[model samples]
Target: MSLHTASCRCGAIRFEARAEPFYASYCHCEDCRRASGSPVAAFVGFYTRDARFIGEAPGTYGAAPVTRSFCRTCGAPLSYVDARLPDQIFMMLGAMDAPEKYPPTVHGYVSEALPFFHIADGLPQMETSTVPRPKEDGQ
Candidate 1:
């Protein structure tokens, strides 16, 4: 209902999201682990247009159709935008001012989740990679 603001660790990039995230998830894919240097990467997806970057544009790298933006100063992952999914943006959960407020609703790429990691009880789980489905022609 209310806007939430988030920023990179070095304060190089900042943004605001006008609504609560539609969904949150923890990704255990290898790419995520490599990028985040953690066992998993947590994200909160929002409507792309609802978010506005403040200050300098964060540096971005395209991984095919998807591009990830991060703070050039600190190398902290900030957000992710996929050309294939233009309507949404996934903000790195750690960047949030109140990270605890956006606990993951699901655990994705669970097949690759770390051997020692145990998913919590109630969150949904998906083994394969998942992306937002496109709307039907009629909307």
Candidate 2:
């Protein structure tokens, strides 16, 4: 099982989660853009059963259907949990020690992507928030 540990900038909050991720993507949704104050937000998903919080629990805010958690000391957005996906936790890639280890395989919410921002990475791009399915056996 793969394991990942991530922390806020000030190290006031940390997270440890094991097992493979359910999904990983770069989200261009407006909500995520506003939350991260960036053109896009990269995130990783893992089953809540294999995750644990260390140090102090971060402060949180209601971001519509989910609660966005962040470090009060450094104000870095760490994780966001959506009730719609109750079994998983979505964490910001930047908070991880080696964000490069989790390369995003898809891009979501392209409809909301800023016109000036273009991603030429060739990954699958979805117009909205659609969970991608794994490739099956040969046709």
Candidate 3:
């Protein structure tokens, strides 16, 4: 896949993903909702080697051992990096220059989804904190 570029609202932070995302998901966890100030947060997952950051690396903080990066100037949440998944990164979908290019494949943390929010019926849904297990692994 060809590389795709993305940036924060103010354009102070930019990034590029070298390939199409492996998957896309919407997170309804409280931290996501609070950090994004949205009912849910959309993310596009890719391998770390497949993505690059232009300009300065954004400010980062550990939300656990996992780190969340954001544009300090604009406070736009940009990406999530985890030691457990050292090779992969999850970029905030809203930061994409063409967010339409990546559509969410699933809804996660459904138990924390807002009571008044309405999720469309067709997409797959999972209630657990982690992603669903692959069929063969039964994670």
Candidate 4:
């Protein structure tokens, strides 16, 4: 099994995933843009069971349903977890050691995207989350 590694800017926090990601996408929501301090943010999603944090624990913020984590030392955003998808964790693409390996397949929250920052990638753009819901839930 191949391993994917990611770390914060100061290397105070790190992440490891032993399996391939389930999804990768660019987010244009205000929450994501604010957290990342960017016009748009990209993420790579993995099963929570397949990913883990190592070295130092990350600082977290947000309400119960959604939590965002960052490196306490460097203040670099690291991960985002939503209770709705308990099995998944989304890591910031920019924080990855090799971000080129996981290119975003879609653009999510297009309705909230900054008008000045157009998405010209030709990828599927959705007004809602691009994360595929489990078939069993039929959501």
Candidate 5:
């Protein structure tokens, strides 16, 4: 897989990943919208082990199911990771050096999607969070 490099708007936070993306998607969930200040958010999923911060580490905020890391300088949203999806990290698609490299395959939390906003991309729309919570170890 080709290298994937991304950074915050102020270039304060940067990261590089070598692992192939598990998937790319757009999320219309309220939390995502609130965090992104956009109608929807696009991100590419990769395991945490496959990615790393460059020089400065961004500030992180943990809220229940997920934790988001962003640049303190430019306040650019960077990555979001959910505990339920261990080892997985989702990086904002726009932050990518080559944003076009990852084309979204799905639109998640479509039920929450704004009525005034819709994409004509023809990607699958999931009515809820597409990443199912992992089962217990003994279950």
Candidate 6:
């Protein structure tokens, strides 16, 4: 199986996803913009089981349902995980070793997109994400 590798800007944190990503998108939410320091951010989603840290785990922010992680050494944003989709991890596309291979297939949260920045890719745009999440099973 091919591995998709990624790391922080300083190489202080590394990870690999052993399986194909389930979804990839360009997000325009304010939270993502703030976390990534960009008006738009792209993320590639993988099953949590397919990804693993290469060294010490990265530092994290927020709590529970929506947590963001970053490289403590370089302060580069890394990943985001939501409890609603507990089995998936969304890694920042900019952090990937081969970002060109996993281009965003859709634009998400367009309602929140900055009016000054526009993408004319003609790809599907959604007011919210179209990525599928596993149905919750009562624990």
Candidate 5's error at 73, in angstroms?
A: 1.1
Number of the top-ranking candidate, with TM-score as the measure: 4
- Give a tens-digit lDDT track for model 5, residues 35-128: 9999999999988888898978899997867999899888999999898887899999999999999999999999999999989988889999
Candidate lDDT scores, in order, read 0.85, 0.88, 0.84, 0.93, 0.90, 0.91
Please report the TM-score between candidate 1 and the true structure. 0.89
Candidate 6 per-residue lDDT, tens place, 1-139, comes to: 9799999998989989999999899999988999999999999999999998787689999866789999899999999999888899999999999999998999999999999999999989999866755566753
lDDT of 1 at 10: 82
Between candidates 3 and 6, the one scoring higher on lDDT is 6
Please give the lDDT score at residue 25 for candidate 3.
Answer: 90
1-139 in candidate 3: lDDT tens per residue? 6888889778888899888788789989888888788999999888888899998679998766568999989888998876767788889998988899999988889999999997885888788645533343454
Winner on lDDT (1 vs 3): 1
> Compared to the true structure, candidate 4 yields what TM-score?
0.93
Q: Any runs in candidate 4 off by more than 4 Å, and if so which?
A: 132-139
Q: Using lDDT as the measure, which candidate wins?
A: 4
Q: Write the per-residue lDDT of candidate 2 for residues 45-114, one digit (tens) a residue.
A: 8889999889998999985568999998999999988776778798899998789888999999999999
lDDT, candidate 6, at 107:
98
- For model 5 the local lDDT of residue 51 reads 88
- Model 6 steric clash pairs: none
Ranking by TM-score: 4, 5, 6, 2, 1, 3
